[model samples]
Target: MLTFEHDYTRLPEPLWLACEPSGVRAPKLIAFNEALARKLGASVVPDDETLAQWFSGNEIPSGAKPVALGYAGHQFGNFVPQLGDGRALLLGDVVDAEGKRFDVQLKGSGRTPFSRGGDGRSPLGPVLREYLVSEFMAAVGVPTTRALAAVASGERVARQMPEPGAVFTRVASSHVRVGTFQFAARHGEETTRALADYVIARHYPEAREQDDPYLALLECVTRRQAELVARWMSLGFIHGVMNTDNTSISGETIDYGPCAFMEQFDPRKVFSSIDEGGRYAFNNQPAVAQWNLARFAETLLPLMNVQGEEGVELAVEVIRGFEAHFDKTRQALRIAKLGLAEDAGDTADTLMDALETLMHQGRMDMTATFDALTHYAEGFDDIRREALLALTDQPEAFDAWLEQWRAAPLLNDATRFDAMRLANPVVIPRNHRVKEVIDSAMEDDFAPFHTLLSVVSAPFDESVEARRLAAPATDSQAVLRTFCGT
Candidate 1:
């Protein structure tokens, strides 16, 4: 019965027309982020029925505005004239216990005026996929959007196959994206500055202290994005898509479709079925991030204080630092994965190159290869050594690399090695495993879904009961292609 206050109607001009939801009949609650719910000062409502009652367009939460946000995006290489929240509605921004502002968004809530003649509903698979991978990313130390909850829409929506529907409770620092600017600037330069001002007041207040807040905003986003792409590489994450709309200004991971973790250590891995040209491949993510940041820079050009060419040069310089920053952070992360904190200079790359070569030649287990290294050095037990031996046909080659690794002055004592394993996860949600879970869920079996969640929740520890999670699937279960649920 708590009605949320909304002041959007008093905006400088109409942002979006008030619209009702379509394509939703019986919305059901699937899951809730208790951590984020407490952060947002929201309490649980009980069962899926209760959640569905609220989301079925039959009930509206008071004090929350069901407003659609406006933003444009580049689909591939082409720009769309306009794109906004088609199936999503903002339930308003909530301040956390620490006073940080975060937006509460509902995906598949229903349709808005932006629906554009399509069914504005999220199928169950993508909802579950986002919940799985987003939570996994957070556990693995990556900055990303968090899934608060998922609810089934007691209704079914038609996609490749007719499927039960669901809604996801997504939490983010702010919904502002690079595409957000593209929308505003296209409206007018005044609208552009206004949006930038709102962003500064809301997220980056320190930018207001600068001489040129708008340009400072651009620089801040670029720096954060550069470092974020670096972190992704360090963890072997492949975003699969780098569209401008998919880029969040808050630097938290957003839009969880078609994303996956690398399995074979291939920098050129392209898991998203839509990425035919490998534009956003595993190795290309860093460059793609720089490219997106460059677009952000171009959007902020009107506020740039420097002359034309010089401003462009400064933007180029900032973008140039992306690769260097990515390399530096990834190298440091690579060292920690190998159980060493200090860099071994060129030796680190040398050993990494050797590992990649061995893994590629032997078709090694990507996640386990780095993790097993620590166990081999620490336990020295046959089980640990055997784990390493199983990775490839080239134990002699790996042994040679391990000698160089073990001889490199140990950065930490044996106890520190134990701590490093905890830092670097041994298990990740592999594509094949994700596919298996999805396949089961498609058949209305939640057992596999829950099983995957349990194993993925603690990716570092290897329980004998959960040993299956550590092992790659047999050759037949190998998943070579992943698709966008669209």
Candidate 2:
């Protein structure tokens, strides 16, 4: 039997509603993360039927206290006072063998009070997408929620069309978000204070040691968001929906809806179908993140050491630091991607800007270009150099930048090569490939899905299959828009 702790439920009742997962018909185990299960100290090896039943909400596990968490969000810059977990339930918390707490959630487990007239279910396409991309993110060393299991409901959900439904088991440090505090603030300052205390105790324990824990909490959350967004930029992963509620306080990439990796290096790329305004474009993530952090800081103003206008000023000061924090992390990642030493200095910035300009002008494939650079760093070969130059339309311009990069001061070829290999991935879950997997899975053929997952699991490895998947989409195969799959 699995064990659970209900620390979140101990908070004010307004924050969550005690609930149960809606049972599904013919729950069949589609995928079970056995390695993650063992890591969470799950010893019982139940049959597939039993596993599916438990995960699909056909049967609740022992010691589980399911609840639909309450939170508000800014949807595309417009504030929604109440936008809770419409289709997800927190089935309590589990502490792994190493003593780290993780929230086990059931997505597509049916409707709760939070479901605003829509079906509280997920299409199998989105479930499989999250499973593949999230696990791939973990493999690539990005902080993200882990997929524990996926079970087919043997039922169809109504979306743009009728689609197979599945419940996804998502494991995370906590589901607390800036929107959580936004909801709490509406309940009054006391509730907001209580929520902050709970979050600090749960995720940022070090903040409690500070003289002003609330301010420290804001600072820590700001730093984490900066680092998180920077990592997302490094991988060309565009989180299509970056609503305030979807922003996790723990800094892990949360909701994977409409999310896709950029195929071509265009800073203006926007893949989300709903985002016609380009509000959450590829280059705007850092600004959006800082904007969300400002919203979070507003929620904590009442608990800060200062009062009224002074407190607002203090919060603004901290929020303004986001740019510096983001730049520091992003610069380090760029330096590593270029396989340059930490002291590469102005040379790094100039080279990165020049390369990005060339890439944007050439409409080069981001992942392929970076992978080629990684190989070139390993050892300068004519073939690798030609391959890198081929990615850009302006070979002369790129060649000029290439010479500057190669001749930069304090060059150590061996260490630089190692750094590049670690920073650049040989493969990502490219848009077209992900669409192919989803298409195959919808027809009950899961071989393509499993094959893609296996390839992405070792992103750094340049295996034959990995190299094959790294190929960019042809014009006809390009997935220009991705849906939320609600």
Q: Give the number of the best model, judged by TM-score.
A: 2
User: Candidate 2: which stretches are off by over 4 Å?
Assistant: none
Residue-level lDDT of model 2, residues 1-486, one tens digit each, is 568999898889679998788898888888888888888879986989999999999888989989999999999999999989999999999898888999999999999889999789999999999999999999988899999999989999998789999999999999999999999999999999999999999899999999889999999999999999999999999999899999999999999999999978999999999999999999999999999999999899989988899889888988899988988888888888888878875677788888888899988888899889888877888999999999888898888888888887634865866778888998999989999998988888888988898889888887899988989999999999999898
Instruction: For residues 40-152, write the lDDT of model 1, one tens digit per residue.
Output: 66654456566566544445666666778777888776788578888888776677668777776778877777778767788888888888888888887788888877777
Please give the lDDT score at residue 14 for candidate 2.
74
Locate the minimum summed-lDDT window of 10 residues in model 2: 409-418
Using lDDT as the measure, the top candidate is 2
Alpha carbon lDDT of each predicted model: 0.74, 0.91
**What's the true lDDT of residue 57 in model 1?**
46
Candidates' RMSD to native: 2.5, 1.1
Error of 1 at 456 (Å): 2.1
lDDT of 2 at 113: 88
